[model samples]
Target: MNKLRQHSFLAFLCLILILPTLVFGECTCDEEEDGDRNKTEALKYKLAAIASILVASAIGVGIPILGKTIPALHPDRNIFFLIKAFAAGVILATGFIHVLPDAFDNLTSPCLKENPWGKFPFTGFVAMVAAIGTLMVDASATSYYSRSHSKNNQAQPVENGGDEEKAGEHEGHVHVHTHATHGHSHGSVDTSPTTQLLRHRVISQVLELGIIVHSVIIGISLGASESPDTIRPLVAALTFHQFFEGMGLGGCISQAKFKARGVAIMALFFSLTTPVGIAIGIGISNVYKENSPTALIVEGVFNAASAGILIYMSLVDLLAADFMNPKMQSNGRLQAGANIALLLGAGCMSLLAKWA
Candidate 1:
């Protein structure tokens, strides 16, 4: 009887250990299956995103360019001012609400080593340095072009200014003197059409660079995600995000009035960047871990830099230039309209942040 009882107790102990092992093994297999299924679903959503975003970007940018054919949408028209104001607001919100926060999140992620990343506010520091660098580039470019154009203006006679060559020379001198005085007084003001056009070109190109950086980062992120639920909502959110951003870029491009070939190239480049980034992400997804130290640092620094460029361009080049214009200041109705449009643009972009 005693031997039988001891044997029974040993059997019970074995059962207790074996039962948990069997249950855990079954759970591990189920988890593996679920992970595979999620990856498959995510791929499908990523493909859909590439297509939808491409279409949305094309339409958004095309609208402003096509609007140039309409009289009311002319750059000089009041309606154009309102449209530009709205676009500027969109850019502002993108920098502050979308890009800047992402930078902070990435830089401060718990996955990074606490010694360096956690010890310093790298995001803010990088962003501030980037902003200063952009300002330097902006000022230097403007000054160089201004001087070049001023020299050309001095050397060449105005077509309608005078008759005799001596009169032309006198007129050129007078014009140069006047421009120099104006520039000195206003601190880099150039009212000539040629100079204005050059500024627009520079602004458009720089703005595109800023937008493209953020676009590519976001695309890679969406593509690398293995969660179908996360990718699904992002598809819609990013579509709107790209559309509005394209509109902002389109407005600048239209104002620059690039030749047909140039315009097409710029538009095509903007439209393709995100899709290309997605492809890259998909190719590397198997090896790409978002929480890795290298990934966090790279994404965080790039995001911070892009945010700086966009914020500077939107506030200094776009909003300030337009809002402080004599035309806007002189007319109360136009001012009100532009203000409303700006708010609406910003609010729309900010709302999209909920999903993206």
Candidate 2:
């Protein structure tokens, strides 16, 4: 009886030792096979995403440009204000709902060290700095252009000014050179057509830069992921995402009134940015690790900066400029329509955050 009991104990110990190896070995093999399958499916989805996103972006941007032929879509028309309001709302939601949270997640990831990343709110700090920097650039550029334009106007010979001065002198009144008459004022606010046009051009370019930065990061993330389950819904969400974003950008570009060559170049560049980013991700997927410290920091910083720029542009440049306009403020119906459109645009983009 003693020998039988000892033999039973020995068998139990042996089974315990061998069981883990057998289970773990089978799990490792299964995991390897699943990883391979996931990679294959991911590549197929990535290819499809690139094609679909590119087409969606092109169509979205094209709509605004084509709308130029429609009388109601003219910039001076009330309906155009509604469109701009909606586009601004989309951009605003993108910055607040989509990019800012991602920046926080990346900066505060567990993969990073706790010393600097965890101790301080680097995401908010970086975004604040970026917003300030954008303001500086915006002000500086506008000031510089205003000065240059003033110089050019001053240099031009005023053909009829001499006659007016003579006539004023003969009437026993001192001739006051009021630049307002020439549509270019030296002091006070200069709301001339030329100045406004230049401002639009600058705003459009800056807005594009912000949008492009965010688009690239998202594209790379989507491309680098090897899980079809993750990529599947993103394909649909991002398609809608790019489409609305393109409309916003297209509205800005149209307002800038660029020449044919410039318009085409800007349109094509915006259309291709996401696909190009995806292609880059595919090329570097073998070596790129999304959770690596370096990748996290870079992506986090860029996303924060982009969020700042987009938020600032949408609120200050796009919405404020139009919403505060005398025309929009005076018309009750137009104001109501614009407000409704803005709400709809923001609601749609915010909903997309669930899937994206």
Candidate 3:
């Protein structure tokens, strides 16, 4: 009889433990149905985001590169400097305000295991490594190209060299006088201009790589989301984000002076990347869980790396190069104007983070 009583108590204990799960399972099913309803509403916004981003990207890129035909937007103009300052500020804020914080959030998310992710600051570590990698690429590419250029220049015959040198020198002298008449000098155009132009090309390519990485990820996140309220504001904010970012990239592309075909291809590529990513996200949304462990790790690392690349490029390649230009330094008014423009651009981008 005593043994029978013990069995009854054991069964009751099991019942008590299992009852909450049975009730909670029903609640979970209800929540899942509500989530589905919300997700269905969000689908409409994804379509809108595609169109908005495509148009915004095209217009933004086209404006600067095509605007080259405009007198004020010429590379030599004070207006161009201000435009670059604005663009640099945008890129800077993108790294700091947008991508970096996102990285921190994802890497430190509770979904991740606490053993490694919580124990170590992986986001920062990845970012620092990424920054160093970018510097290596920048330095190595510049060195390799510089060496190749010097070799090619050396390989030319004296006869060809003499004629080319004469022509190059004439062009350089003309450039100096032209800038001088505009109240500044572009430094020695004979040698530095060629090297500078090459560097610009490198910068454009690397900057695009960094920007594209984040762009695709952002698009995917947007596509995978099932919240209309989350996506709605992102649509507007990302639109502006792409627009200003395109301007930054366009500035570099314009300065690089790539062939018309190259520019067209690049512009198209940039415009398409995010939209394509969105399409991919939509396809995989059924299985794509944003807060899942694998997704968080991948997206977090990529975002951190991208942030590092942009920060490095903006500071070292874009802002520093222009701010230290002889022309900008010579004119105090221009310097002050550019500084204000930079602040305005950064402030605007930072504000967008609240919604995006």
Candidate 4:
């Protein structure tokens, strides 16, 4: 394990050092003198993007969480499933339409050499590996927590068992209570609400990680651009993008039932990440060339990995789990409604890709 950690750290360091050299072909650093009007327009768009995305994200997340107060939006209702299906579709579209395409464009840019870079499909490969890695982490974490919980439960007798055992002792019938206790233990081992809740928590955290990575990268790109034309359309598109993405994340976080503090932290973090990335980009814009080999490689790799994680989580954890549930399967009308909602979400998000 130690060796594995060491190797992983070394690989990360090497990537950081080597990314700048991936292409020596050309740098699209246009040094054209833009008049003060252009500068003012760019600043206007940048601020607009920041404020719009921030408000959109906050409203998106807040709606779902606050929806708990509305009976119609309760998790147990069919409407909730439809909402979740829509959110899952948005996430699926984001991974496939937004992040994956960006990854491919970056890795296959004309600026890169045709030797080794063009020889292999790094974008697809990285995405595949990242998806498999997420599965492994998901499986391992679930197993570890389940096993630990089982062991802890075993170490302590059930509350009912203690009362039954005491009665059995008083009545000189300990064997009867022992047998009943065994049956209860078997049932507890088979299924538990705590275990299910823990799994949701894990899914929520991993999903947030994937979403935040892509969000920050997009923000940086938007911030670094000096082109007012490019920034103009992006501001509107990314506002909608952040809003939909936040809804997806909010659903997961609501299901996870995190503490008040945890929910606040996550919502704030999601709301602030894009703005923070933009801030970082503005600060480094003088040296941050978007077309630079380092920027391309890092952004491409991260985007690909994020795509994989989001896709897997959307398909396996969110959509499949809900679609296959007894509640959904039993109600054909509900299922059909959810399917339509899913398509609508995917279509809306896909359309945004045209500009973003």
Would you estimate the TM-scores of all the predictions? 0.85, 0.86, 0.84, 0.83
Off by over 4 Å in 2: 1-30, 158-188
lDDT of 1: 0.86
Clashing residue pairs for model 2:
none
**What is candidate 1's lDDT per residue for 165-275, written digit by digit as tens?**
343244222243554544543233475455667778888898999999999999899888899999998999889888888888888899888999999999998998898
Q: Give the CA lDDT, 0 to 100, for residue 320 in model 3.
A: 94
Best candidate according to TM-score: 2
Clashes of 2: 0
- Candidate 4 Cα errors over 4 Å, as ranges: 1-35, 160-191
Model 3, residue 29: what's the lDDT?
80
Least accurate 10 contiguous residues by lDDT in model 2: 168-177
lDDT of 3 by residue, 192-279 (tens): 7767877888999999999999999999999988889899999999999999999989999998899999999889988888888888
Q: Candidate 2 on 24-65: residue-level lDDT in tens?
A: 767778899988999999999999999999999998887777
Model 2, global lDDT:
0.86
lDDT of 1 at 9: 94
Backbone collisions counted per model: 0, 0, 0, 0
* Model 4 lDDT per residue over 102-196, tens place: 99999999878887779999999999998999999988888887777556545655465566555434322232324465575423432345566
Candidate RMSDs in Å, in order, are 5.3, 5.9, 6.5, 15.3
**Backbone clashes, candidate 3:** 0
Error of 1 at 8 (Å): 21
